[model samples]
Target: MIVNLTTLDQDQAIEQISQLEPQLFGTSAWSPNAIRQELNAPARTYWADIDPTTTPGNPVIRGYAGIWFDGYDTQIMTIGVAPQHQHHGIGQTLLQQIIDQATADHAERILLEVRVDNTPALTLYTKNGFTRIGLRKRYYQPEGIDAYTMALPLNPHTIGFQPTHA
Candidate 1:
């Protein structure tokens, strides 16, 4: 099920993020403090994918994503699905939420950067109509990985795109 990240979910989300950080972001995972600060930021909105079937105190978070919007544009700050929960449309659900949020905020466009080597993420973004607009050299620090800058225009008459299905 989809839900906004609440104060009650903070500790659990942080724990899940910590476990996936090394695998998802390699050496560039955001620190726990950094994640907390981002979640508390005024202009940021984050959401979590949870299993509604779980018991009260043991809620399972399958994935999480965040975006930063400033009225004009929205940038996807982070997105990840637990390894075991991947390939189950969770990532697409999280991404669609951000797209909808950007549309609601009247953003002109949505932007994000992904490592050039992450084929799965690249495929997901491309399928959602985000086009490669530019590149940032060595964007991922410590590892010296380059990134592709992508954007999805949010024209008023065409605020969102249809999700492609195979």
Candidate 2:
């Protein structure tokens, strides 16, 4: 249940992102306007995870994931699942879709950062072959939380590892 976030789907995407801010960042980290600005940015490529069979205006944007691919390895800008939709494989599905899109777009790798304390998200990323590569101190604002940087190298010829965290 994944699709590209085209211009026509701007408003819907904004609404969904706004709804996730409170629970995700524990604050109004992303407002509709802020989301629109980023989603509509000329330099970024956005994507949405809607029910694969749904139509426009009726799209079930339970989770939103986006990347900023500047014609190179994509940077996963943001990813969030609806509070009620968390831990139901929605995050994994969204990440896979983004990975597929990155592959289709000819990206050699995909990079992202997750809050160091976000175990569920870290698990999802680790299970998708993304490895911890670095750290971003105080990556999240407000109270200044840090994040772990991760990247997934894409190559069918190479063995992909999906580590299961205990």
Candidate 3:
């Protein structure tokens, strides 16, 4: 139930991690300050999926995602759905938002690293056209889990790029 996807503001940023950190990232959860910095970064885009049908003063954040754009390339910084809300296409909606933002910013491709053992994440990325391009040994900290690097090439034409006559 994707109602309106909104940029995560300062107040919401704190709430985001507080509510979903333990459930989504476990021990590797990012600090609220870090999230604030990311939200304020010039080259980053972050969005929160809100379900408007929820009760007043208690908005439910279905999911959230962020991306970093650097001219011709984009990297997915993070994407997650609350444990209770998983497998409901909210993740896909969040992913598409980042892809759209990257495309609008003229990114030629998107890249991300996912824990190798996370089958659901791998499945979602693969379904969305991301392919395994490389691997990072022990990329995840503390637990020392390996990671798979994936990339998705974007079509310039589909991103609304128009060539100008010289």
- The model with the greatest lDDT is 1
- Displacement of residue 31 (Cα, Å) in model 2 is 2.0
Please list the Cα RMSD from the true structure of every candidate, rounded to 1 decimal place: 6.6, 7.2, 4.5
Expressed as tens digits, the lDDT of each residue in 1-166 for candidate 3 is 4433343345764676567876887776777777777777887777777776877556677787888888878999989898988988889988888788877887889999999999999999999999999999999887888999999999533557678899
TM-score of each: 0.89, 0.82, 0.84
Backbone clashes under 3 angstroms, per model: 0, 0, 0
Off by over 4 Å in 1: 156-166
- Cα error, residue 13 of model 3, in Å, equals 3.2
**Candidate 2: regions farther than 4 A off:** 51-56, 155-166
Error of 2 at 128 (Å): 0.8
The candidate scoring highest on TM-score is: 1
**Structure candidate 3, residue pairs in collision:** none
* Error of model 3, residue 157, in angstroms: 13
| lDDT by residue (tens digit), candidate 2, 17-93 | 78777878785278778888888786676666676667767787778787887777888988888888787888887
Per-candidate local distance difference test: 0.89, 0.80, 0.80
Q: Weakest 10 consecutive residues, lDDT, candidate 3? A: 1-10
Pairs of residues at least 3 apart in sequence or in different chains that clash in candidate 2: none
**Number of the candidate with higher TM-score, 1 or 3:** 1
Clashes of 1: 0
How close to the true structure is residue 89 of candidate 2, measured as C-alpha lDDT? Answer: 85
